[model samples]
Target: MTLLWIITALWAVSFSLIGVYISGQVDDTIAVTTRMFLALLIFLPFWRPAPWRKSLRMMATGAVEIGLTYLFLYQSYHYLSVPELLLFTIFTPLYVSLFSDLLARRWPRQFWAPALLAVAGAAVIRWTDLSGDYWIGFAFIQAANACFAFGQVWYRQQSMGNPLPHRARFAWFFLGAFIIAGSAMLLTADWSKLPATPVQQGVLLWLGVVTSGLGYLGWSYGSTKVSAQQLAVMNNMLIPAGILVNVLFWGGHIEQWPRLLLGCACLAAALWLCRKRTPAPSRST
Candidate 1:
Protein backbone atom coordinates (compact mmCIF):
# COMPACT_ATOMS: atom_id res chain seq x y z
CA MET A 1 0.00 0.00 0.00
CA THR A 2 2.84 2.36 0.78
CA LEU A 3 4.48 1.44 -2.45
CA LEU A 4 1.31 2.17 -4.40
CA TRP A 5 0.94 5.55 -2.77
CA ILE A 6 4.57 6.40 -3.55
CA ILE A 7 4.23 5.48 -7.18
CA THR A 8 0.94 7.33 -7.36
CA ALA A 9 2.76 10.47 -6.32
CA LEU A 10 5.50 9.82 -8.85
CA TRP A 11 3.02 9.27 -11.64
CA ALA A 12 1.15 12.43 -10.68
CA VAL A 13 4.11 14.46 -11.88
CA SER A 14 4.37 12.25 -14.94
CA PHE A 15 1.00 13.43 -16.23
CA SER A 16 2.10 17.06 -16.27
CA LEU A 17 5.54 16.32 -17.65
CA ILE A 18 4.16 14.29 -20.50
CA GLY A 19 1.59 16.95 -21.32
CA VAL A 20 4.08 19.80 -21.18
CA TYR A 21 7.11 18.18 -22.78
CA ILE A 22 6.07 15.26 -24.94
CA SER A 23 2.35 15.20 -25.88
CA GLY A 24 2.23 17.47 -28.91
CA GLN A 25 5.94 17.65 -29.71
CA VAL A 26 6.76 13.95 -29.80
CA ASP A 27 5.05 11.28 -31.85
CA ASP A 28 2.79 9.29 -29.51
CA THR A 29 3.77 5.89 -30.91
CA ILE A 30 7.46 6.70 -30.77
CA ALA A 31 7.14 8.01 -27.24
CA VAL A 32 5.37 4.88 -26.03
CA THR A 33 7.82 2.63 -27.90
CA THR A 34 10.82 4.38 -26.42
CA ARG A 35 9.39 4.18 -22.92
CA MET A 36 8.66 0.44 -23.22
CA PHE A 37 12.07 -0.39 -24.68
CA LEU A 38 13.81 1.57 -21.99
CA ALA A 39 11.72 -0.08 -19.29
CA LEU A 40 12.48 -3.49 -20.83
CA LEU A 41 16.21 -2.75 -20.64
CA ILE A 42 15.88 -1.79 -16.98
CA PHE A 43 14.53 -5.20 -16.07
CA LEU A 44 16.66 -7.19 -18.53
CA PRO A 45 19.68 -7.64 -16.29
CA PHE A 46 17.47 -9.11 -13.53
CA TRP A 47 15.81 -11.54 -15.96
CA ARG A 48 15.95 -15.26 -15.33
CA PRO A 49 14.63 -18.06 -17.46
CA ALA A 50 11.02 -18.97 -16.73
CA PRO A 51 8.48 -21.43 -18.08
CA TRP A 52 7.33 -20.44 -21.56
CA ARG A 53 3.67 -20.33 -20.55
CA LYS A 54 4.29 -18.03 -17.59
CA SER A 55 6.46 -15.68 -19.67
CA LEU A 56 3.82 -15.59 -22.36
CA ARG A 57 1.10 -14.67 -19.87
CA MET A 58 3.13 -11.81 -18.47
CA MET A 59 3.83 -10.58 -21.99
CA ALA A 60 0.18 -10.72 -22.92
CA THR A 61 -0.76 -8.73 -19.84
CA GLY A 62 1.78 -6.08 -20.73
CA ALA A 63 0.61 -5.92 -24.30
CA VAL A 64 -2.97 -5.22 -23.31
CA GLU A 65 -2.27 -2.98 -20.31
CA ILE A 66 0.60 -0.80 -21.34
CA GLY A 67 0.80 -1.18 -25.10
CA LEU A 68 -2.81 -1.17 -26.19
CA THR A 69 -3.93 1.16 -23.42
CA TYR A 70 -1.38 3.78 -24.42
CA LEU A 71 -2.34 3.45 -28.07
CA PHE A 72 -6.00 4.18 -27.30
CA LEU A 73 -5.23 6.90 -24.74
CA TYR A 74 -2.86 8.81 -27.00
CA GLN A 75 -5.17 8.66 -29.95
CA SER A 76 -8.04 9.95 -27.84
CA TYR A 77 -6.11 13.20 -27.40
CA HIS A 78 -6.84 13.95 -31.02
CA TYR A 79 -10.53 14.20 -30.22
CA LEU A 80 -10.74 15.11 -26.53
CA SER A 81 -9.24 17.82 -24.43
CA VAL A 82 -7.24 16.84 -21.34
CA PRO A 83 -10.17 17.74 -19.10
CA GLU A 84 -12.50 15.58 -21.15
CA LEU A 85 -10.10 12.67 -21.07
CA LEU A 86 -9.72 12.98 -17.32
CA LEU A 87 -13.47 13.13 -16.92
CA PHE A 88 -13.89 9.97 -18.95
CA THR A 89 -11.44 8.07 -16.78
CA ILE A 90 -13.91 8.19 -13.90
CA PHE A 91 -15.37 4.94 -15.24
CA THR A 92 -12.12 3.03 -14.67
CA PRO A 93 -12.75 2.39 -10.99
CA LEU A 94 -16.02 0.67 -11.84
CA TYR A 95 -14.26 -1.42 -14.44
CA VAL A 96 -11.57 -2.40 -11.95
CA SER A 97 -14.16 -3.45 -9.40
CA LEU A 98 -16.22 -5.39 -11.94
CA PHE A 99 -13.29 -7.16 -13.58
CA SER A 100 -11.59 -8.06 -10.33
CA ASP A 101 -14.82 -9.46 -8.98
CA LEU A 102 -15.46 -11.39 -12.21
CA LEU A 103 -11.97 -12.87 -12.25
CA ALA A 104 -12.48 -14.11 -8.71
CA ARG A 105 -15.87 -15.62 -9.61
CA ARG A 106 -17.39 -13.94 -6.55
CA TRP A 107 -18.68 -10.50 -5.90
CA PRO A 108 -17.90 -8.74 -2.66
CA ARG A 109 -20.76 -6.31 -2.36
CA GLN A 110 -18.68 -4.16 -0.02
CA PHE A 111 -16.32 -3.35 -2.88
CA TRP A 112 -18.83 -1.39 -4.91
CA ALA A 113 -19.44 1.44 -2.45
CA PRO A 114 -15.85 2.61 -2.20
CA ALA A 115 -15.31 2.16 -5.90
CA LEU A 116 -18.34 4.28 -6.68
CA LEU A 117 -17.31 6.84 -4.10
CA ALA A 118 -13.96 7.11 -5.78
CA VAL A 119 -15.69 7.66 -9.08
CA ALA A 120 -17.74 10.43 -7.57
CA GLY A 121 -14.57 11.98 -6.16
CA ALA A 122 -12.82 11.92 -9.51
CA ALA A 123 -15.87 13.32 -11.23
CA VAL A 124 -15.83 16.28 -8.87
CA ILE A 125 -12.21 17.00 -9.61
CA ARG A 126 -12.38 16.76 -13.41
CA TRP A 127 -16.00 17.54 -14.26
CA THR A 128 -16.41 20.17 -16.98
CA ASP A 129 -18.37 21.07 -20.09
CA LEU A 130 -17.74 18.65 -22.96
CA SER A 131 -17.41 19.26 -26.70
CA GLY A 132 -16.02 17.71 -29.92
CA ASP A 133 -16.59 14.14 -31.13
CA TYR A 134 -18.09 13.09 -27.83
CA TRP A 135 -19.07 9.54 -28.74
CA ILE A 136 -15.85 8.66 -30.56
CA GLY A 137 -13.62 10.07 -27.82
CA PHE A 138 -15.70 8.43 -25.11
CA ALA A 139 -15.37 5.08 -26.84
CA PHE A 140 -11.60 5.42 -27.18
CA ILE A 141 -11.16 6.38 -23.52
CA GLN A 142 -13.41 3.54 -22.41
CA ALA A 143 -11.38 1.05 -24.44
CA ALA A 144 -8.22 2.29 -22.77
CA ASN A 145 -9.87 2.16 -19.36
CA ALA A 146 -11.10 -1.38 -19.87
CA CYS A 147 -7.72 -2.60 -21.06
CA PHE A 148 -5.95 -1.06 -18.06
CA ALA A 149 -8.51 -2.38 -15.58
CA PHE A 150 -8.43 -5.86 -17.10
CA GLY A 151 -4.66 -6.01 -17.12
CA GLN A 152 -4.35 -5.11 -13.45
CA VAL A 153 -7.00 -7.57 -12.37
CA TRP A 154 -5.68 -10.33 -14.63
CA TYR A 155 -2.07 -9.93 -13.48
CA ARG A 156 -3.13 -9.91 -9.85
CA GLN A 157 -4.97 -13.21 -10.36
CA GLN A 158 -2.21 -15.07 -12.26
CA SER A 159 -0.46 -17.93 -10.54
CA MET A 160 2.73 -19.20 -12.19
CA GLY A 161 4.35 -20.91 -9.19
CA ASN A 162 7.66 -20.18 -10.88
CA PRO A 163 10.87 -20.15 -8.84
CA LEU A 164 12.10 -16.87 -10.28
CA PRO A 165 11.34 -13.70 -8.32
CA HIS A 166 8.75 -11.30 -9.76
CA ARG A 167 11.42 -8.71 -10.48
CA ALA A 168 13.30 -11.26 -12.53
CA ARG A 169 10.16 -12.26 -14.38
CA PHE A 170 9.00 -8.70 -15.04
CA ALA A 171 11.30 -8.45 -18.02
CA TRP A 172 8.89 -10.64 -19.93
CA PHE A 173 6.13 -8.14 -19.22
CA PHE A 174 8.06 -5.23 -20.72
CA LEU A 175 9.24 -7.43 -23.55
CA GLY A 176 5.62 -8.05 -24.43
CA ALA A 177 4.86 -4.34 -24.31
CA PHE A 178 7.89 -3.68 -26.49
CA ILE A 179 6.65 -6.10 -29.13
CA ILE A 180 3.32 -4.29 -29.47
CA ALA A 181 4.50 -0.71 -29.01
CA GLY A 182 7.59 -1.18 -31.16
CA SER A 183 5.56 -2.65 -33.98
CA ALA A 184 3.08 0.22 -33.76
CA MET A 185 5.88 2.76 -33.83
CA LEU A 186 7.46 1.21 -36.86
CA LEU A 187 4.20 1.18 -38.75
CA THR A 188 2.77 4.57 -37.81
CA ALA A 189 5.13 6.91 -35.97
CA ASP A 190 6.08 10.18 -37.60
CA TRP A 191 9.85 10.45 -37.66
CA SER A 192 9.40 14.11 -38.42
CA LYS A 193 8.01 14.73 -34.91
CA LEU A 194 10.78 13.01 -32.99
CA PRO A 195 12.07 14.86 -29.92
CA ALA A 196 14.50 17.59 -30.95
CA THR A 197 15.24 19.57 -27.79
CA PRO A 198 17.38 18.31 -24.91
CA VAL A 199 14.49 19.00 -22.52
CA GLN A 200 12.27 16.69 -24.52
CA GLN A 201 14.89 13.93 -24.58
CA GLY A 202 15.51 14.32 -20.86
CA VAL A 203 11.81 14.20 -20.13
CA LEU A 204 11.41 11.06 -22.19
CA LEU A 205 14.36 9.46 -20.43
CA TRP A 206 12.87 10.21 -17.00
CA LEU A 207 9.47 8.95 -18.12
CA GLY A 208 10.95 5.72 -19.44
CA VAL A 209 13.25 4.98 -16.54
CA VAL A 210 11.40 6.21 -13.48
CA THR A 211 7.76 6.48 -14.55
CA SER A 212 7.34 3.38 -16.73
CA GLY A 213 10.07 1.16 -15.32
CA LEU A 214 9.88 1.71 -11.61
CA GLY A 215 6.27 2.86 -11.60
CA TYR A 216 4.82 -0.30 -13.17
CA LEU A 217 7.04 -2.53 -11.09
CA GLY A 218 5.89 -0.94 -7.87
CA TRP A 219 2.22 -0.88 -8.90
CA SER A 220 2.17 -4.57 -9.88
CA TYR A 221 3.77 -5.66 -6.65
CA GLY A 222 1.63 -3.33 -4.60
CA SER A 223 -1.53 -4.76 -6.14
CA THR A 224 -0.65 -8.05 -4.51
CA LYS A 225 -0.91 -6.62 -1.00
CA VAL A 226 -4.33 -4.97 -0.93
CA SER A 227 -7.96 -6.00 -1.33
CA ALA A 228 -9.80 -5.53 -4.63
CA GLN A 229 -11.84 -2.71 -3.11
CA GLN A 230 -8.72 -0.91 -2.01
CA LEU A 231 -7.15 -1.31 -5.41
CA ALA A 232 -10.27 0.00 -7.12
CA VAL A 233 -10.44 3.13 -4.98
CA MET A 234 -6.72 3.73 -5.29
CA ASN A 235 -7.11 3.99 -9.04
CA ASN A 236 -9.04 7.23 -8.53
CA MET A 237 -6.31 8.68 -6.31
CA LEU A 238 -4.51 9.61 -9.49
CA ILE A 239 -7.13 12.19 -10.36
CA PRO A 240 -6.59 14.41 -7.34
CA ALA A 241 -2.89 13.71 -7.30
CA GLY A 242 -2.48 14.64 -10.95
CA ILE A 243 -4.53 17.80 -10.49
CA LEU A 244 -2.40 18.78 -7.50
CA VAL A 245 0.72 18.16 -9.52
CA ASN A 246 -0.43 20.43 -12.29
CA VAL A 247 -1.44 23.19 -9.89
CA LEU A 248 1.94 23.03 -8.17
CA PHE A 249 4.39 22.58 -11.01
CA TRP A 250 2.75 23.35 -14.35
CA GLY A 251 1.09 26.69 -13.66
CA GLY A 252 -2.28 25.09 -14.33
CA HIS A 253 -5.37 26.71 -12.88
CA ILE A 254 -7.70 25.12 -10.42
CA GLU A 255 -10.82 27.23 -10.43
CA GLN A 256 -12.66 25.55 -7.60
CA TRP A 257 -10.56 24.79 -4.58
CA PRO A 258 -13.64 23.94 -2.51
CA ARG A 259 -14.72 21.33 -4.99
CA LEU A 260 -11.20 19.92 -5.17
CA LEU A 261 -11.07 19.67 -1.39
CA LEU A 262 -14.46 17.99 -1.28
CA GLY A 263 -13.37 15.47 -3.89
CA CYS A 264 -10.21 14.62 -1.97
CA ALA A 265 -12.25 14.24 1.18
CA CYS A 266 -14.48 11.74 -0.58
CA LEU A 267 -11.47 9.77 -1.77
CA ALA A 268 -10.10 9.71 1.76
CA ALA A 269 -13.40 8.49 3.14
CA ALA A 270 -13.51 5.74 0.53
CA LEU A 271 -10.00 4.59 1.32
CA TRP A 272 -10.83 4.48 5.01
CA LEU A 273 -13.97 2.49 4.35
CA CYS A 274 -12.07 0.00 2.24
CA ARG A 275 -9.38 -0.37 4.92
CA LYS A 276 -11.94 -1.21 7.56
CA ARG A 277 -13.40 -4.07 5.54
CA THR A 278 -11.94 -7.54 5.89
CA PRO A 279 -9.55 -8.17 3.03
CA ALA A 280 -10.43 -11.16 0.92
CA PRO A 281 -7.19 -12.64 -0.28
CA SER A 282 -6.88 -13.53 -3.94
CA ARG A 283 -6.33 -17.23 -4.66
CA SER A 284 -3.07 -16.52 -6.51
CA THR A 285 -1.52 -15.07 -3.38
Candidate 2:
Protein backbone atom coordinates (compact mmCIF):
# COMPACT_ATOMS: atom_id res chain seq x y z
CA MET A 1 0.00 0.00 0.00
CA THR A 2 2.87 2.37 0.74
CA LEU A 3 4.38 1.54 -2.63
CA LEU A 4 1.05 2.17 -4.29
CA TRP A 5 0.75 5.58 -2.64
CA ILE A 6 4.22 6.55 -3.84
CA ILE A 7 3.52 5.40 -7.38
CA THR A 8 0.20 7.19 -7.36
CA ALA A 9 2.02 10.46 -6.64
CA LEU A 10 4.50 9.78 -9.42
CA TRP A 11 1.67 9.01 -11.83
CA ALA A 12 -0.09 12.23 -10.83
CA VAL A 13 2.84 14.20 -12.14
CA SER A 14 2.90 12.03 -15.25
CA PHE A 15 -0.68 12.99 -16.08
CA SER A 16 0.25 16.67 -16.15
CA LEU A 17 3.52 16.11 -17.98
CA ILE A 18 1.81 14.20 -20.75
CA GLY A 19 -0.88 16.84 -21.07
CA VAL A 20 1.45 19.82 -20.99
CA TYR A 21 4.58 18.52 -22.72
CA ILE A 22 3.76 15.58 -24.94
CA SER A 23 0.11 15.47 -26.02
CA GLY A 24 0.01 18.24 -28.60
CA GLN A 25 3.66 18.36 -29.53
CA VAL A 26 4.08 14.67 -30.30
CA ASP A 27 1.91 12.25 -32.22
CA ASP A 28 -0.01 10.03 -29.79
CA THR A 29 0.99 6.82 -31.51
CA ILE A 30 4.65 7.79 -31.60
CA ALA A 31 4.63 8.82 -27.97
CA VAL A 32 3.00 5.62 -26.83
CA THR A 33 5.30 3.51 -28.96
CA THR A 34 8.44 5.28 -27.83
CA ARG A 35 7.42 5.08 -24.21
CA MET A 36 6.76 1.35 -24.37
CA PHE A 37 9.91 0.68 -26.38
CA LEU A 38 12.05 2.52 -23.89
CA ALA A 39 10.38 0.77 -20.98
CA LEU A 40 10.98 -2.59 -22.62
CA LEU A 41 14.63 -1.74 -23.08
CA ILE A 42 15.02 -0.97 -19.39
CA PHE A 43 13.95 -4.48 -18.41
CA LEU A 44 15.59 -6.35 -21.27
CA PRO A 45 18.86 -7.00 -19.44
CA PHE A 46 16.99 -8.92 -16.70
CA TRP A 47 14.82 -10.97 -19.07
CA ARG A 48 14.74 -14.74 -18.95
CA PRO A 49 12.77 -17.22 -21.00
CA ALA A 50 9.46 -18.34 -19.56
CA PRO A 51 6.81 -20.84 -20.62
CA TRP A 52 5.26 -19.79 -23.91
CA ARG A 53 1.77 -19.87 -22.45
CA LYS A 54 2.60 -17.57 -19.53
CA SER A 55 4.58 -15.25 -21.75
CA LEU A 56 1.65 -14.95 -24.15
CA ARG A 57 -0.76 -14.04 -21.35
CA MET A 58 1.55 -11.34 -19.92
CA MET A 59 2.06 -9.92 -23.40
CA ALA A 60 -1.65 -9.78 -24.12
CA THR A 61 -2.27 -8.12 -20.77
CA GLY A 62 0.31 -5.45 -21.53
CA ALA A 63 -1.10 -4.91 -25.00
CA VAL A 64 -4.54 -4.03 -23.72
CA GLU A 65 -3.59 -2.36 -20.44
CA ILE A 66 -0.68 -0.13 -21.42
CA GLY A 67 -0.71 -0.11 -25.23
CA LEU A 68 -4.38 0.20 -26.09
CA THR A 69 -5.16 2.19 -22.95
CA TYR A 70 -2.57 4.82 -23.88
CA LEU A 71 -3.97 4.99 -27.42
CA PHE A 72 -7.42 6.00 -26.19
CA LEU A 73 -6.07 8.24 -23.43
CA TYR A 74 -3.83 10.30 -25.71
CA GLN A 75 -6.56 10.62 -28.33
CA SER A 76 -9.03 11.89 -25.71
CA TYR A 77 -6.66 14.74 -24.90
CA HIS A 78 -7.42 16.09 -28.36
CA TYR A 79 -10.90 17.06 -27.12
CA LEU A 80 -10.84 17.23 -23.32
CA SER A 81 -9.08 19.45 -20.83
CA VAL A 82 -6.62 17.79 -18.42
CA PRO A 83 -9.02 18.15 -15.48
CA GLU A 84 -11.84 16.72 -17.57
CA LEU A 85 -9.69 13.73 -18.39
CA LEU A 86 -8.90 13.16 -14.73
CA LEU A 87 -12.55 13.52 -13.77
CA PHE A 88 -13.68 11.08 -16.44
CA THR A 89 -11.48 8.39 -14.94
CA ILE A 90 -13.54 8.35 -11.74
CA PHE A 91 -15.58 5.58 -13.37
CA THR A 92 -12.49 3.38 -13.34
CA PRO A 93 -12.79 2.39 -9.66
CA LEU A 94 -16.21 0.88 -10.31
CA TYR A 95 -14.90 -0.95 -13.32
CA VAL A 96 -11.95 -2.21 -11.32
CA SER A 97 -14.18 -3.56 -8.56
CA LEU A 98 -16.64 -5.15 -10.98
CA PHE A 99 -13.98 -6.80 -13.11
CA SER A 100 -12.01 -8.00 -10.11
CA ASP A 101 -15.07 -9.67 -8.60
CA LEU A 102 -16.11 -11.16 -11.91
CA LEU A 103 -12.67 -12.56 -12.55
CA ALA A 104 -12.43 -14.00 -9.06
CA ARG A 105 -15.88 -15.56 -9.39
CA ARG A 106 -16.79 -14.18 -5.99
CA TRP A 107 -18.76 -11.00 -5.50
CA PRO A 108 -17.43 -8.92 -2.65
CA ARG A 109 -20.28 -6.54 -2.04
CA GLN A 110 -18.31 -4.43 0.43
CA PHE A 111 -16.24 -2.98 -2.41
CA TRP A 112 -19.13 -1.26 -4.15
CA ALA A 113 -19.64 1.34 -1.43
CA PRO A 114 -16.08 2.59 -1.39
CA ALA A 115 -15.89 2.49 -5.15
CA LEU A 116 -19.02 4.57 -5.52
CA LEU A 117 -17.92 6.90 -2.75
CA ALA A 118 -14.67 7.51 -4.56
CA VAL A 119 -16.60 8.31 -7.70
CA ALA A 120 -18.76 10.78 -5.82
CA GLY A 121 -15.66 12.39 -4.37
CA ALA A 122 -14.05 12.78 -7.76
CA ALA A 123 -17.32 14.08 -9.22
CA VAL A 124 -17.48 16.72 -6.52
CA ILE A 125 -14.00 17.92 -7.41
CA ARG A 126 -14.78 18.47 -11.10
CA TRP A 127 -18.34 19.75 -10.85
CA THR A 128 -18.37 22.21 -13.71
CA ASP A 129 -19.41 22.78 -17.32
CA LEU A 130 -18.49 20.28 -19.96
CA SER A 131 -16.85 20.93 -23.31
CA GLY A 132 -18.62 20.56 -26.66
CA ASP A 133 -16.77 17.32 -27.35
CA TYR A 134 -17.26 15.99 -23.83
CA TRP A 135 -19.16 12.82 -24.74
CA ILE A 136 -16.64 11.82 -27.39
CA GLY A 137 -13.77 12.33 -24.97
CA PHE A 138 -15.72 10.57 -22.23
CA ALA A 139 -16.21 7.51 -24.42
CA PHE A 140 -12.52 7.26 -25.19
CA ILE A 141 -11.57 7.62 -21.53
CA GLN A 142 -14.09 4.95 -20.50
CA ALA A 143 -12.63 2.52 -22.99
CA ALA A 144 -9.17 3.16 -21.61
CA ASN A 145 -10.41 2.87 -18.06
CA ALA A 146 -12.11 -0.47 -18.63
CA CYS A 147 -9.09 -1.91 -20.38
CA PHE A 148 -6.73 -0.78 -17.63
CA ALA A 149 -8.95 -2.10 -14.85
CA PHE A 150 -9.42 -5.45 -16.52
CA GLY A 151 -5.71 -5.84 -17.13
CA GLN A 152 -4.73 -5.08 -13.54
CA VAL A 153 -7.27 -7.50 -12.09
CA TRP A 154 -6.35 -10.19 -14.57
CA TYR A 155 -2.64 -9.86 -13.89
CA ARG A 156 -3.19 -9.97 -10.16
CA GLN A 157 -5.07 -13.26 -10.45
CA GLN A 158 -2.68 -14.99 -12.83
CA SER A 159 -0.59 -17.89 -11.50
CA MET A 160 3.00 -18.28 -12.55
CA GLY A 161 4.45 -21.69 -11.68
CA ASN A 162 8.00 -21.39 -10.40
CA PRO A 163 8.75 -18.85 -13.04
CA LEU A 164 11.42 -16.16 -13.08
CA PRO A 165 10.96 -13.34 -10.60
CA HIS A 166 8.50 -10.66 -11.65
CA ARG A 167 11.28 -8.25 -12.56
CA ALA A 168 12.83 -10.84 -14.85
CA ARG A 169 9.49 -11.66 -16.44
CA PHE A 170 8.29 -8.05 -16.64
CA ALA A 171 10.08 -7.44 -19.91
CA TRP A 172 7.47 -9.59 -21.60
CA PHE A 173 4.82 -7.17 -20.39
CA PHE A 174 6.46 -4.16 -22.07
CA LEU A 175 7.33 -6.25 -25.10
CA GLY A 176 3.63 -6.83 -25.54
CA ALA A 177 2.94 -3.10 -25.13
CA PHE A 178 5.63 -2.25 -27.66
CA ILE A 179 4.16 -4.59 -30.25
CA ILE A 180 0.78 -2.85 -30.20
CA ALA A 181 2.01 0.72 -29.78
CA GLY A 182 4.79 0.25 -32.32
CA SER A 183 2.38 -1.03 -34.90
CA ALA A 184 0.07 1.90 -34.30
CA MET A 185 2.96 4.32 -34.63
CA LEU A 186 3.88 2.79 -37.98
CA LEU A 187 0.31 3.20 -39.21
CA THR A 188 -0.47 6.75 -38.03
CA ALA A 189 2.57 8.62 -36.73
CA ASP A 190 3.37 11.98 -38.27
CA TRP A 191 7.07 11.96 -39.14
CA SER A 192 6.98 15.75 -39.19
CA LYS A 193 5.85 16.08 -35.57
CA LEU A 194 8.66 14.05 -34.00
CA PRO A 195 10.25 15.60 -30.88
CA ALA A 196 12.04 18.75 -32.08
CA THR A 197 13.25 20.27 -28.81
CA PRO A 198 15.51 19.19 -25.95
CA VAL A 199 12.59 19.51 -23.53
CA GLN A 200 10.51 17.13 -25.61
CA GLN A 201 13.27 14.55 -25.73
CA GLY A 202 13.89 14.90 -21.99
CA VAL A 203 10.20 14.55 -21.26
CA LEU A 204 10.00 11.46 -23.44
CA LEU A 205 12.95 9.91 -21.62
CA TRP A 206 11.49 10.69 -18.20
CA LEU A 207 8.12 9.26 -19.21
CA GLY A 208 9.67 6.15 -20.70
CA VAL A 209 12.20 5.38 -17.98
CA VAL A 210 10.77 6.75 -14.76
CA THR A 211 7.05 6.87 -15.44
CA SER A 212 6.38 3.92 -17.73
CA GLY A 213 9.21 1.68 -16.66
CA LEU A 214 9.41 2.11 -12.91
CA GLY A 215 5.85 3.28 -12.48
CA TYR A 216 4.24 0.25 -14.09
CA LEU A 217 6.62 -2.12 -12.38
CA GLY A 218 5.88 -0.68 -8.96
CA TRP A 219 2.15 -0.46 -9.59
CA SER A 220 1.91 -4.05 -10.80
CA TYR A 221 3.87 -5.33 -7.84
CA GLY A 222 1.86 -3.25 -5.44
CA SER A 223 -1.43 -4.51 -6.84
CA THR A 224 -0.50 -7.96 -5.63
CA LYS A 225 -0.22 -6.74 -2.05
CA VAL A 226 -3.77 -5.52 -1.51
CA SER A 227 -7.34 -6.76 -1.88
CA ALA A 228 -9.37 -6.10 -5.01
CA GLN A 229 -11.58 -3.88 -2.87
CA GLN A 230 -8.58 -1.89 -1.67
CA LEU A 231 -7.27 -1.68 -5.21
CA ALA A 232 -10.67 -0.39 -6.37
CA VAL A 233 -10.71 2.44 -3.83
CA MET A 234 -7.05 3.23 -4.27
CA ASN A 235 -7.61 3.82 -7.97
CA ASN A 236 -9.55 6.98 -7.11
CA MET A 237 -6.70 8.39 -5.06
CA LEU A 238 -5.17 9.37 -8.38
CA ILE A 239 -8.04 11.76 -9.12
CA PRO A 240 -7.40 14.12 -6.21
CA ALA A 241 -3.65 13.74 -6.45
CA GLY A 242 -3.62 14.46 -10.17
CA ILE A 243 -6.00 17.38 -9.76
CA LEU A 244 -3.71 18.89 -7.15
CA VAL A 245 -0.76 18.53 -9.52
CA ASN A 246 -2.70 20.17 -12.32
CA VAL A 247 -3.89 23.04 -10.18
CA LEU A 248 -0.49 23.68 -8.68
CA PHE A 249 1.83 23.22 -11.65
CA TRP A 250 -0.20 23.04 -14.86
CA GLY A 251 -2.32 26.19 -14.36
CA GLY A 252 -5.53 24.16 -14.30
CA HIS A 253 -8.57 26.40 -13.89
CA ILE A 254 -10.12 24.76 -10.86
CA GLU A 255 -11.66 26.61 -7.91
CA GLN A 256 -8.81 25.75 -5.60
CA TRP A 257 -9.85 25.69 -1.96
CA PRO A 258 -13.16 24.37 -0.62
CA ARG A 259 -13.95 21.96 -3.43
CA LEU A 260 -10.55 20.32 -3.33
CA LEU A 261 -10.77 19.91 0.43
CA LEU A 262 -14.22 18.36 0.22
CA GLY A 263 -13.07 15.96 -2.46
CA CYS A 264 -10.05 14.92 -0.42
CA ALA A 265 -12.27 14.37 2.60
CA CYS A 266 -14.54 12.11 0.58
CA LEU A 267 -11.61 10.14 -0.80
CA ALA A 268 -10.14 9.73 2.67
CA ALA A 269 -13.48 8.56 4.01
CA ALA A 270 -13.71 6.00 1.21
CA LEU A 271 -10.27 4.64 1.94
CA TRP A 272 -11.06 4.40 5.61
CA LEU A 273 -14.23 2.44 4.86
CA CYS A 274 -12.27 0.05 2.66
CA ARG A 275 -9.63 -0.54 5.35
CA LYS A 276 -12.33 -1.50 7.83
CA ARG A 277 -13.50 -4.34 5.61
CA THR A 278 -10.65 -6.82 5.86
CA PRO A 279 -9.57 -8.32 2.55
CA ALA A 280 -9.66 -12.01 1.85
CA PRO A 281 -6.44 -13.95 2.18
CA SER A 282 -4.08 -13.47 -0.73
CA ARG A 283 -4.71 -15.84 -3.56
CA SER A 284 -1.86 -17.95 -4.85
CA THR A 285 -0.43 -16.55 -8.05
* Model 2 poorest ten-residue lDDT run: 276-285
Q: What lDDT tens digits, residue by residue, belong to model 1 across residues 154-259?
A: 8887733556666886798899999999999999999999989999999989988999899998998898778766787678778778876777778877567787
Cα lDDT of model 2 by residue, 1-285, tens digit: 999999999999999999999998999998999899999999999988888988899899899889999999999998777876886676677667667656767565687788678767766765674445765786798899999998888888773353567787679899999999999999989988898888988999999999999998999889888877678767888987898899899899856668867876776677566556634424542
Error of 2 at 194 (Å): 0.6
lDDT of 2 at 43: 95
In model 2, which runs have C-alpha deviations exceeding 4 angstroms? 106-132, 159-162, 255-285
Q: In candidate 2, how many Å is residue 210 off?
A: 0.5
Residue 160's lDDT in candidate 2: 36
Pairs clashing in candidate 1? none
Task: Report residue 160 deviation for candidate 1 (angstroms).
Answer: 6.3
lDDT of 1 at 100: 68
